[model samples]
Target: MSGRKFAMKKTKSRRKKWASSQLFYEYSTFFRKNADNVIFQVTSDQLPTLNRIGLDDLFMSKGHIREPHWHPNAAELDYVVTGEVVIGMVDPIRHHLLQFHVTPSQVVFIPINWWHWITAVSDDVHVVQVFSSAKRQIIEGSNVLRKTPPKVFQQSYDVNAKQFASLVSPIKETVVIGPPDRYALTNLSDEHPESVPRVVNHTPPGSPNLFFDLKRNLAVRRDHSYLYEVTSTQIPMMNVLSLGDLYLTMGHVREPHWHPNADELDYVISGEVTVSILDPNTLAVCNYRLKPGQVTLIPKGWLHWIIPYTEDAHMLVYFNDGKIESVEGSDILRLTPADVFQRAYDIHAREFTREISSITGTLMIGPPDRPRR
Candidate 1:
């Protein structure tokens, strides 16, 4: 009886299969940690919808720092949600430093294995970091220092063993996020004017900051939908990934399309959307109705479309590859050999040609002359 009870309890503790009913997640309620700063994260372990990607939201107080760290398995795309922050990254392969004074609505990408850190420049700074993988293995600077053999450190820079041990031995615990030893609240009224929070507007030379506003002059802006995409054309130095923000009005749809070069991860920021994706190989379709704080992942070369469920739907799309090449459904249908399609459908060639001729260009966002059944 006791053995049977223990086995039943173990089975009950096992994780359930990923289900469509579990597609929606409020990442704010995910795991969070506070040690001078607050960091919230959602991973595949927490929400299977993030099986291929993960996200972190850092809330940092003034003078706090998200410690220098590197992910062994993922690159990072960071967007400043509010206030200001400074990001410093070291290029792993090239051995060069990239620094940016990032502000609201700005973005930055840190390649995998690149050491990077963020510092809060305002009293309340919030940043969202997107990872390319579901589980990011972080190697924090403090952990690295603590794990290094004393003899290796003594031989590395000619530091004596006693001093090296003294420096690292007292660090009893890791500080994932912290302020400098002397960090204090700045009061402009009682201190020098320079003590007040100031904007960080510099993009150091050679660093080529990949910061762009989503609402800036867009690549495509229509009456019902608009998109702002960050690609090599906009920021030359970046090649790790491309970021895009898309907005659609009520009743509007982001037409069926497939990206040839990249898989897409979509996060709904506001409003609701019904997303449909079809896999060409198996002809399998996955459809979901996602609301604010929900996300969907579409594999590369899968046909997909998004229909707004509310007015002013906004979403962010991230692609692994830096370059973007989308093949729209309209383009494929309009350019298809009319006679071939007509024969396949057993329709008149002229009628088929005339029916699709109206699709002159890509219908990026569409009403389709009528609702698509």
Candidate 2:
């Protein structure tokens, strides 16, 4: 009776925990909207299972800019999903300004505490920014420019206090998407060229390469599925964030695996997919069916796999570690001695060995095609 009661208690506890675990979120319903620009965010606040990883879906129109800002606690990996943008950042080590023109399927890395900004170069631009922290803290340039007293500017730079005050007066609030709608525009020629910081189009030697083209670098290509990845190996500038662009068709599976060092957030771009995760604590398997604009989070070291339900499923997987180290399920089954399996489960050793002989390597995507008898 005691054993039966303990089993029932455990089952009840598992049900309670599963009921509270949130593995799916919709981006379309939860977003911060600006006039012509918008941002959708996913952090620990929204998904309790998230660990040291977050994402922001940002959209901007031509000539608009995502105001200059610096994240105090996170490194950012920006992946361009559509259109083009110019990413500008100030290198603190060299005190140089660097700019890169990024188009669709490209990426730019911004180190933690680096001042950076983005300007849309095309009509419709969508960039997904992945952060290393669950809750990324930001300090906007508008706050710095508006909050500082004009007298301090005059004292430091020897500028007219009244003129400086007038110039910044229009910035009443945090202008996330700039040129504030009420602000007037004026074209003025550069009168003090020497004062302007020289902008460089290319990175200096010995400096981290900040730009990479994901489409050009295909990590894996199969008949029905393909993946593109970006990590510290590809761009040393990537501090603690990495990305994988994945596309899988119906009947295709992202083979079961576990990341030993990094947490994962999967964001669906098109079609539908089902993500399965096995919780180590409760020994329960949870399955989440996600559609376009939906997302799921998998904690570090958790066993998981993805299967597509539609013909053209696309998703982006983000990780908190720049170098993702994973252990594939196929490797474990194929490498384990048949005798060990027999000893553990009382199975026929020879049959187990023969059954797994076909799995000679890491099968990232499975069911190897075999001729039907």
Candidate 3:
């Protein structure tokens, strides 16, 4: 009785401390709107539990661009949720300008500090950009162009000082989305040989694969539950970030497991789910019920599981490492000797062995058979 009382007291104390740890955030509430385009961000500042990971929920209309920019502190993995986009980036190492036309379910990865920009190809373009750092620091090209003296352009690149100044005069401030709202929209399809660079099929030797289609790669499928994953193995350019697109029906559970090499951020796309994480620091189980547009962060190596509360629950799970390594609870139970468990916990060895005999391999989803519930 004394031991149980002490344990209860300890749990109460830990709960007090854990109460301050925020694990959920709504992306819709805190967003930056630029005319018709909107950018919703979730970083450590918004979700205090976030560590070494963040996301930007981008929305743009046709012909608009997510202005030329680069993240100095984080590598980015951009996944197209709807419509189409043309992702352009300058490879710093090779000094080559690379561009990829991405469609729905496709993704483009940008290495850290690489200058990149996204232009909407179809109307209502939606892209989810995941970052390696909790707080991604960006340097916008508009600021660089508008802030730098015209004389510097002439001195550095041999451009006419007055012409450069006049060209950039319209850029009044940081243009998150371009061309600024004040400027009339132009026909992007109109070809201007002088201004538009010709598209070429140039593949340099040893170039990394930056673009991938998640829909083309299905990791696993069981009944109504399915998982699609993109990792370094799929896209070599991906270094610090990967994604797992998961769907589950009611009674389905993303079985208890822990990523040994990466931290996970779960963003709900539809329906509802309960993300349960075992806090290593507090040794307490914390469960967060999430709905669409909500997110939860799970630290690396923390035992966690997900159970869908409603049918059609879809989640986008982002990891800090390109190569994800997980230790499944099913694997642990199946691999461990029954005698070892019996010796440690003073249980019936033969009964334990018989109980776990059905678990032959890794069960990413619980209940090998259909759930009666």
Candidate 4:
């Protein structure tokens, strides 16, 4: 059902909260609204996450084109949902040209900071572009043509006007998103790639939401192509962590806990979700009710929980730091000695339940790499 619209019941009062604003909030799709096309900027709880940037889908006629442009830090990941596209890019070194009859499952990877151009080869071509940096860091760029005339850019880039221009026409060019690529990887703490926890990436397509039961250890793709993993590759970053856009997903509920290691960021892509986070410093509570484009950030070591507010909603999740680990939260509470959580939550032993026995005594723990995703 490519490009088919599915019925999604809108909630009357979608405004709901998980805990308190001390830690969570929601924003709508307005972040990228412009006269041109639609682009949704959603992420949770990070300085860079809330900052919006340009990432959008462009629809072109038989010969429409997105003129040549360049950014210092932005790299585009384009996937053809329908029709064919001709893409060309060049940096200081070499030029690359690829003419592809891309379909639903095909993707074209474009590196960062390369001057690039695209022309639609289909009657109506649609494509998705993901920025290497967050939306915030890619808004202001020198539209190469602005330096001179349209023809100058074409000539400077060695693009043939008569032949190429005839084949590539201008579609729609509008500006509606922000700042630039300002953030840098200041502190990527030391860690071995071998420490990444096993993850099962699954989601059924034809829906905006995706679910991966990390606690229960499950995933449902809904028919959409859910990439489980890419292995044995010699690339620097080969896992989902390297995806250009944030990982968009949703689930029933995430147990109350926190990652002592990394910060977790999320935006309510659609539907409603409540996230409760504990403040390790203040010992108080911070709750958030996130909606479309609204972000919920879970700082490291802050105990947290998440759940669907209505029938079901999708929240965009990404490790702002770009490091991920599959911590077995359920097993921690169930199997770990009472003293551990007792010290963390400052609760009495009487508060513990028999369910803890079922949690701690399970025989199903092992390397989830094979069955994960």
Candidate 5:
């Protein structure tokens, strides 16, 4: 049975339908109407299968900052889509500060429970932060400091209660994103000149900027189809997710494959494509026809494939792991003994051998045949 029908039959009117629409938040409009810097999230609450993966869209204008925050339940993997930003984080375990100047195509990872914040460097900045959970868990710095009571801070730091109270008075509310006012004295650049981010590579010895430039890290292709990935192999600091940008020409396919340990979420960036995912658990199949801005989540260990519906389609895929481990469908089908196929399906041995003999290697992306009209 198809995944859609199975979901309905199993629930039997107890639950509403599983989400079918692609997650397409109008980020530009959301940010413009909101008072502060914008953040839109998509999680299991929005789509059930999204329980294993979540995404947050962040947008900020010049001088604005995303307040320092930490996720207790998920690690954050941020990808810069446009403009520039400086990310600063406090490593509680290491007892040090880590910062990075991130630009388009660059990525950064914040380990779980680490306090981190981002400030836009350009006129406008757009970032996509992916989390390894259905819902993002966050604790803002302002809330932590403000709610602790001035007396507690005074005792802990051996400071005067009156002085500490005055110091923390500005933290009136949880500033999800700041500055409290356009001309506020608490602006990051004005008050924290020493922490200003420089463009130069300032990767500390142990904590490096997990940045990967796609222009430099090219994945060779047989035809026009190509795939470029950033995993732990490329950046040791990456601990949460592996990112990939894939391009496929019309009439080609990103061959069937399954990740051994990661769930894959894809954001279609250009053109159109059709994706098929087969669930091994229930032996059910689901298909999604996607266009730009649409996203699809393939559960972990599910067999899946992608075929382009237009010329030069592009997709950004995120895996919930630092390294990608995949088992290609071609490898499974071609490696089995030829007689196994004949015995299982009652196929003639000669025909089975001939069919299996032609597959030379694991084809990651396509046989390059034209699609039927």
Candidate 6:
């Protein structure tokens, strides 16, 4: 359970299926130590979000060093996305350092409170690490950090602070977070041997398991709201939505109606749900008991409802379409039909057109010109 005392408040319209208004960070945990955790890429259903989540063509740096730290709350899991990493953890009770220089061509797991460190070998290490702490969670408690005075931690061990400093990096390294500088750690790699040859982090699923968890991509961002804390998003200039936060929630009764400008892409995050869609031409209702991974497309301009089966049924939804984004949702729900949305917002159709294209945004020129499948 998240030890965070903060509550996941209902900040927006309760009528909506998703609660996506203010929360920022999906979650955070210690990275840097487990190189294998950095590289694993899995299907979207495995993610807590119901929408599309992707990481394409990212190369890990060789000098890359993870901070030595542990989190008070939230457990951590890491998957080796690409390359190999030298991992070491302090297992005080076992009376030996619990360290593994691993090469999981696919994935690796890191238990909570495992104060650890990771570094790239020959290739840039790619990893996928997940956290369940309150947004903005950082490395705290029982840590042998880069900033720990070498003199203080030394004498007991043969390594002194200066030599220890050489072992830990100060570029990407941080007392907490080092400034984002690309540094080369040839010195460290010489002492710590590299791992075995491996495949690129992207390995297709063996049996296509729909239930693997990809919660490691989550991070905590204190600057933003809790929901959005540490969470990052991309909005393309063409109005094409690349990644969106989508997930499902279920109850026995028909859900309240809500809409946002962001196009919602949905699937069963879990469980079964009956959905009702209302457009000008049709008011159609479909009930489905979606399992672990199922996709349900929700077109724009259609009012919809979800009737959940299990008391805790869930679904994944891409609630935001680039054209009709969060601002659109806020405008639609907060404003009246009589208000001129463009004038009140001080934005003209041309302004919007310049920012987004008619293709992706589906400009209100007349009838929508969306291509049919």
- Which has the greatest TM-score? 3
Clashing pairs in 2: none
Score every model by TM-score.
0.75, 0.87, 0.88, 0.52, 0.79, 0.34
Q: Write the per-residue lDDT of candidate 5 for residues 282-317, one digit (tens) a residue.
A: 565567777654567887788889989899887788
Q: Which ten residues in a row have the lowest lDDT in candidate 4?
A: 1-10
Q: In candidate 5, residue 311 scores what lDDT?
A: 93
Which ranking of candidates, highest lDDT first?
3, 2, 5, 1, 4, 6
Among the numbered candidates, top lDDT falls to: 3
Per-candidate clashes, comma-separated: 0, 0, 0, 24, 0, 49
Per-model C-alpha lDDT, please?
0.69, 0.78, 0.79, 0.42, 0.72, 0.38
Candidate 3, residues 45-139, lDDT tens digits: the string is 88877888999878777767888999889999998877778888988888778888888777888999999998886777777789999999999
lDDT of 4 by residue, 1-373 (tens): 1221111112332333343333443332432322222233332222333322234444444434455666565545555545666655543343333233344334444545556666554544555454444452442223322333457646678876565544323322332321112312122112323221222222223321111112121232322212121111212222222221222234335555555555566544446667676766666666666655455566656677666566545443443322344455666666677777678888665457443444433212221212322
After the best TM-score superposition of candidate 2, give how far the Cα of residue 29 lies from its true spot, in angstroms.
7.7
lDDT of each residue in 266-328, candidate 1, tens digit only: 776667788887756556566677665456677777789988888888777877677778998
**Candidate 6 residue 146 C-alpha distance from true site, Å:** 7.0
Better of 1 and 5 by lDDT: 5
Query: Which residue pairs come into collision in candidate 5?
Result: none
Instruction: At residue 139, give the lDDT of candidate 5.
Output: 89
Where does candidate 6 stray beyond 4 Å?
1-59, 140-373
Score residue 188 of candidate 4 by CA lDDT.
15
Task: State the weakest 10-residue window (summed lDDT) of model 6.
Answer: 1-10
Sequence-dependent TM-score of model 5: 0.79
lDDT of 2 at 59: 76
Off by over 4 Å in 2: 1-20, 28-36, 183-201, 369-373
Task: Decide which is better by TM-score, 4 or 5.
Answer: 5
